[model samples]
Target: MPVFSCADAIGGGTEPNGSEVVAVRVGQHDGYDRLVIEFNGPIPAYSVTGRSGTSFTTSPKGQTVTLGGTNGVLIVMHSIVNWTSYLGPYAFEPNFPVLREARQIENFEGYQQWALGIQGSPCLRVTTLTSPSRLVVDMAATR
Candidate 1:
């Protein structure tokens, strides 16, 4: 229910360089939480590694969900060039049950900000010029 949009930031054309926005959604499924990521544009070849280091390859564009630990989720967008470089590595920790409550806060305002780091080549920025993309993280309430 809670929707976080990164388009407002990059869509405004503030960053002349290419930019890629990842929108994340979190929800509860059975006993574990599920994360649904929607890629707005072309994404480079990458994988989602669990906190334990288990990695899974992802397609260039589409949506996918995986179940695992509650250490939160990390989205690593690599091989990014131009404007897309602005979108560095981003992570999210979504609250269960209240998931719908968070989506109400669009424009990424009032939401907890996660730390993002560049994987390699600090000088080289991940850049992209196209529609806004997204990465959603849904947290399940602990019973």
Candidate 2:
């Protein structure tokens, strides 16, 4: 393992007013970094993409955020928002080997954006799960 591992990228069109991001969690897997987002409503639609260095995630309302990282990844959920009403806390940077940080950038108009900073060439896989509607992101430790 190169310190990170991933299978494939995941992308889907997300709709507004579906769910909200309640919390973020990260754990070290066998060969990948696991990042999960807890949801309070239905599982939202989302898109994921890899980035280089600092990048921006602009909302529909012209809101943009510059996230930090060398080969960062972005996950934009259309059906969720980082609402204050949710009773969960977020861990911005767990300082994992592959996943350096998870930065919650913006929460506006039912849209939520998060950044996953990587140290090397990023390998990633995105997923959705039940039992409380969660979004999962996995990054590879090696090629």
Candidate 3:
């Protein structure tokens, strides 16, 4: 079993083609830490991959994202541009054993980017749901 919540979001989101990155949420479950991103409509293709370095830099733009953690999970949403700002007073990071940092990196050309600085890179799993479209991420709290 698991739980879900939309606890943090800053600067709101941008409207590109009438679509926006509606929310980024986090919650503590009995066995894992859960994260969810919501869209105003159906979700598009996305990827969640573990990073090998402490920071990630976007292509062509060279914006380096520094997230201090032993592990990193890069999240990219294809089909929507950022349409929002997520930095300074708007940054969202749980700073927990499972998730250390979360940010809205880029939202340009119909693509959105986010990252999760994680502790120890625990097992990561992903799922998608409709009815106000969401991408759910579950990271194991225990090895």
Candidate 4:
């Protein structure tokens, strides 16, 4: 099992329109995954989107984030002891390096990790990792 905390990265106040944008840290634990979102105030509803690559839709409840593309990956981390046993089998070798590095960050402790990479002329790379109850998303812009 892993431990998760949302005290460090939660920034900005709740969106005045009953929404907020939070950069969550996700991780894995005990065969499950988790996510931790930080905010200055209560966040009723929010959605997260990538700058490029694949485009997806997420409901206002912030519970589901759907993704599409050739190499798109999505992980949901919402608890402090969730593991990543739900990620179905696929070719996950090439992405190990980026995932390992993001997992080493202190803010991403005990969170589940999910990643997605679109091959060929990609504008940016989005890597999401989670522990027991946190999520860490890394977006690398290409030039």
Candidate achieving the largest lDDT: 2
Q: By summed lDDT, which 10 consecutive residues of candidate 3 come out lowest?
A: 4-13
Instruction: Kindly list the per-residue Cα lDDT of model 1 for residues 39-86, writing each as its tens digit.
Output: 545544333322322122233322233323323223443433332323
On a 0 to 100 scale, what is the lDDT of residue 77 in model 1? 39
Per-model TM-score versus the true fold: 0.32, 0.76, 0.75, 0.24
Candidate 2 stretches greater than 4 Å from native: 1-17, 57-69, 87-91
Question: 38 in model 2: Cα distance from truth in Å?
Answer: 1.3
Which structure is stronger by TM-score: 1 or 2? 2
Decreasing lDDT order of the candidates: 2, 3, 1, 4
Ranking according to TM-score, highest score first: 2, 3, 1, 4
Query: Per-residue CA lDDT of candidate 3, range 55-87, in tens?
Result: 888644878878867777777766564555322
lDDT of 4 by residue, 71-138 (tens): 33343332322222323232233333222211111112223233444332222222222332112333
Q: In candidate 2, what are the lDDT values of residues 7-43, reduced to their tens digit?
A: 3355543455456677788898877788898877777
Clashes of 3: 5
For model 4, what is the error of residue 112's alpha carbon versus the real structure, in angstroms, after optimal superposition? 20
Which stretch of 10 consecutive residues in model 2 shows the poorest summed lDDT?
1-10
Model 3 per-residue lDDT at 115: 75
